[model samples]
Target: MKQSEIIKRLSDKELKKQVFLSQGLLLIVGVGLSFIFFDTFADWNSIMGWKPKQILFYGVIPGLGIVLLDIFIMRIFPEKHYDDGGINKRIFKNQSIGFIFVLSSLVAISEELLFRGVLQSVFGYLIASILFAVVHFRYFTKPVLLLSIFSISFLIGYLFEVTNNLYVTIAFHFTVDFVLGLIIRFKL
Candidate 1:
């Protein structure tokens, strides 16, 4: 079967919601696995370059970009309120400012540790990045979505590769999520 046919098999709303939930669950599992067996949480200095300014630039900027991107996309496409019951609403209600901050920080920090630090440093960036994109597959619908995720992940991984600083990518991830959270909170 063609890839697009397979992609179309899942309803858009179902795919979006399922992917969002699945990614969250996977993150929890990944963190659990990391803590239980791997001793994954090493000193930040070991993985990141010690530069305070970078946090503002890399973290804050890309984070804002993501939030803005979401707004722009939604403005263009403007999805209707397609809830599968109260599930989506409940999820959003529960996931307010505090939830956004905590989750974003956790994902930003943890994803960097798992993907850039453990996987890339141990195996290779190319392999690790592909894995990262694969895990995020549920978050996107089109093959282009996969391409974007893969590209972004690889670029972030490459930054880590070049700078030997997880801080750079961590900053990027954190900033993106933080801003996105604020956007949601403000209903902007």
Candidate 2:
């Protein structure tokens, strides 16, 4: 069966379940990899720094900027260019605001922890950014979506590199996913 046909066959509950399962796996892998790679808790703490200013500046501000740009693109471009087998809509459209927040937060934390915290820390920015984009394999057939994800990945990785804080990237990822998920939920 074609990909869209497969997507269409899956119920929203199943999609949400798969999403949760996948993110849970990512969280496990991220934590496991961190433990394997870091020599001590202090090493992990160094990268997982907590600072309000860094979160606000490096994360929230840039995330909002990317959302605005995405909104602009959605307005100008055809919907087909941004399609992802309707997965985002199926996962988010009927979800409650609280559920959206929770889902987005889970995704942001797990993905950032794995991609930026573990992969980028060990392999550097370029590889981590590329792997991040590649992991969103569904976007490969859509050039615009692929490029957008790649650019976003690169930006998030850069933020981690500059701030040397996983929290910064997590906040940024959360901002983007939360706001976008809200937009989807509300059909905005």
TM-scores, all candidates, are 0.65, 0.97
Candidate 1, position 131, lDDT: 89
lDDT of 1: 0.64
Q: List the candidate 2 regions with Cα displacement exceeding 4 Å.
A: 1-3
Give the alpha carbon lDDT tens digit for every residue of 20-133 in model 1: 665576567655655654553564456666777765666556657765765665576535321123232333343557766766677777787778766787678999899888
Per-residue accuracy of model 2 over 1-188 as CA lDDT, tens digit each: 87677778888898899899999999999999999998899988898778999899999999999999999989998989988878999999988999999999999999999999899999999999999999898988888899899999999999998999999999999999999999998989
Compared with the true structure, model 1 gives a TM-score of 0.65
**Residue pairs in candidate 1 whose N, alpha carbon or C atoms collide under 3 angstroms:** 59-171, 59-175, 63-175, 63-176
Best by lDDT: 2
Query: How big is the RMSD of model 1?
Result: 6.4
Q: What is the C-alpha lDDT of each candidate?
A: 0.64, 0.92
